[model samples]
Target: MSKFMVLVKQLYKQKVSAKSFILTTLLYLVVLAGIMYWSEIRDLIFSGDADTIAVVNETNFDVSEVLQNTDDYEYEYVTAGEVAEKLKDGDYYAAFTLTDADGKLAAKIESYDPLPLNDQQSFQGMLSQAGQIYAMSQLDLSPEQQQLLLSSEPIITLNSINEAAADGKSADEKMAGVWISYAIGIIIYIFVATYLSIITTDVASEKGSRALEMLLVSVKPEIHFRSKIVGVFLVALTQFIILFGGLLLLLRFSDGGNKWSIVTNLLDSMSIGYFLYVMGFLFLTIFMYLIIGALFGSLVSKVEEAGQVMMPAMMLTLVGFYVMLTGMGNPDTMLIKVFSYIPFTSGMVMPMRLGATDISAIEPIISFGLLLGTVLALYFLSLSFYKRSVLTYSSGGIIEKMKTVFKVTT
Candidate 1:
């Protein structure tokens, strides 16, 4: 326990400066502000009523009679000869003209201002109802029958095999999925950026300050290298654990007994099995990324060279995110199923598809096992590189480095 505490303390001491902590905190604060701003705007946009629109009745058609019966929008009727001119003069936000020809009704709405989407839809529905009512009256139907014909009947049958459900999720549910994807994406992004950048800076700073010479005397290169990798990995994992726990707590209590906050809906809708699967994938992927990133960091002599060395890991990240994007629509396809089994991209792809569709639990478990295996193999391989490259710096492909690490000489 003491040894573990010592290692953790050493790791935390490296980046515990006031400036770094403050900067990180400020960045999160700014992000929170942005999220709040977006919510305010969304509420404002969706909460408004459709603007009051006027109708002109010139063909002895009671446009008011037809419009008033509909619940979609409020309309005022004016007895005017030049309806188009009246609409253009801005007495109303919009004006719909009513005309009957050959026992059929036709309607058109002219707007002086930009029409809201809901308003446009309501206007179109009003026109349809007007046509139906006029047509029914010509057939000598009573008012009750006309009203019945105008109203839509509720259907009990709902059929959608996840594909149709792709678009049918309510705004809150859709927003939740989108927010979750983005939240996960951001977690991956920050983990990679922080740990990888930390390692690169550590290598370059040690090399620059000539500290490697003094530190190399007591500790074997492999021990020092493993300690650094393990230390940073542990730090990242700890921060992730802390953040995840905090987020979970926040999610649990976010509703404030309102029963309708975004955080509550997210937790309520998520299945236990699905939650476990996502957590497993996240943990496995972070383990793999930390090891791979540490290896990339160790191979470079200076921080400037770290980016070039880290290309493979970066490429893996890109592929993982790209596969996630592609898997959005056809989660059940054979190609998607196969991709979910692969180690590198599966972390991002599989969870996203599962969030969007129904994926069997067995497949995720198998994929998780593969990812763990890959992490182990990569960690050992990275340890070899760290041993060879920490003291000795050279420019070569990763394949050539592999030969040197294994002591293969021709």
Candidate 2:
């Protein structure tokens, strides 16, 4: 036990102190911070270039009162000659003429430079509102009558068949849950893929250099393997903590009006029980990947072969990631429900389903049992493969090596 602890500590230190690890951690923090403040960054970069629009009203409809300026646009009432002169001089970003056509109001928008879609949409909206107000005034309608005519009808309430379906969650909360589930799935996929690659590379490198032989003289193969798994797992856990902790701090200090506040609120609104269940499945999935990665790493006789050995694990992780992303859109799909029970995919699918729908407790309990059983079975099987293949020098591909391991074990 003491020897295993020492090995675990040694591996953990080696990994955490590496330049790649340090750089990757810093990059993740920087990127996450950038994403969190992207809206502010965008405003800082583009807000100064507010477009100026000239509105020429040919109809006697004093629409200038309705054409308000925003931070991104400045609207000015101008003459038709001014519009033509500005277009020729390139003095305004855009210009539009409001004229009476076929006994109704019509707008013809022209610009020297192409206007943004939002600016065009805003102008269209202003024209519509002004036309409505003019028509109401011509009809001699009261303010209350005008308001009633302009107002939207009451929204119909949506009721779900599932009586227990996210009973109290608002639309924003439900959408936030989908985003949170997606974010969590992406995080798990990244962490699992990254750490598994690290484990495979480390094990293969040591084996290629014959370091494993020398180390095995003092330590059992199973202990060494298990320690390496635990050590890499710890490194992943540490990175997750630091990255999420920094994000939390940023969220804490951020203005409530920021878009990232939505993400923070969604996280806070998540049930602890749901988080625990997802995490339990996630941890088991990580363990299964680590063990399988170590086993593949053990079979490789050269560092150059590490990527080939790790390809299948990478593919599996990618499949799970994409499937979970698809499932987020429709969590109640039969395909998602079926995949949620699969140990390889459950890590991604189950959490999304749980967050987006009302799942029975027994479903997740069964998934946990299956995932746990799969991990334990794979644990012993991987140890057997590792014990048999670790010391063998092979110049063969993964299939050939796997066959050799099985033959020797049998």
Tens digits of per-residue lDDT for model 1, 106-223: 7767887778898788778778877776677788877787777768576554455666233343434444554565467567756766776676667656754668667767666666
TM per candidate: 0.68, 0.85
Name the lDDT of candidate 1. Answer: 0.65
lDDT of 2 by residue, 1-410 (tens): 49999999999999999999999999999898887777777788988777788888888777767777777778888888778777768778888788876557788889876778887788788788887777666777887988888895877566677875545455555666677778878987998899889999999999999999999999999998899899999998889889989988777665664646666577787788888987897788888899988999999998899999999989988888888888767777888888888888888888887777766778888988999999999999888778888988777778999887777767
- Model 1: lDDT of residue 300: 56
Clashes by residue pair, model 1: none
RMSD of 2: 3.5
Runs off by more than 4 Å, candidate 1: 1-8, 16-21, 41-186, 237-266, 396-410
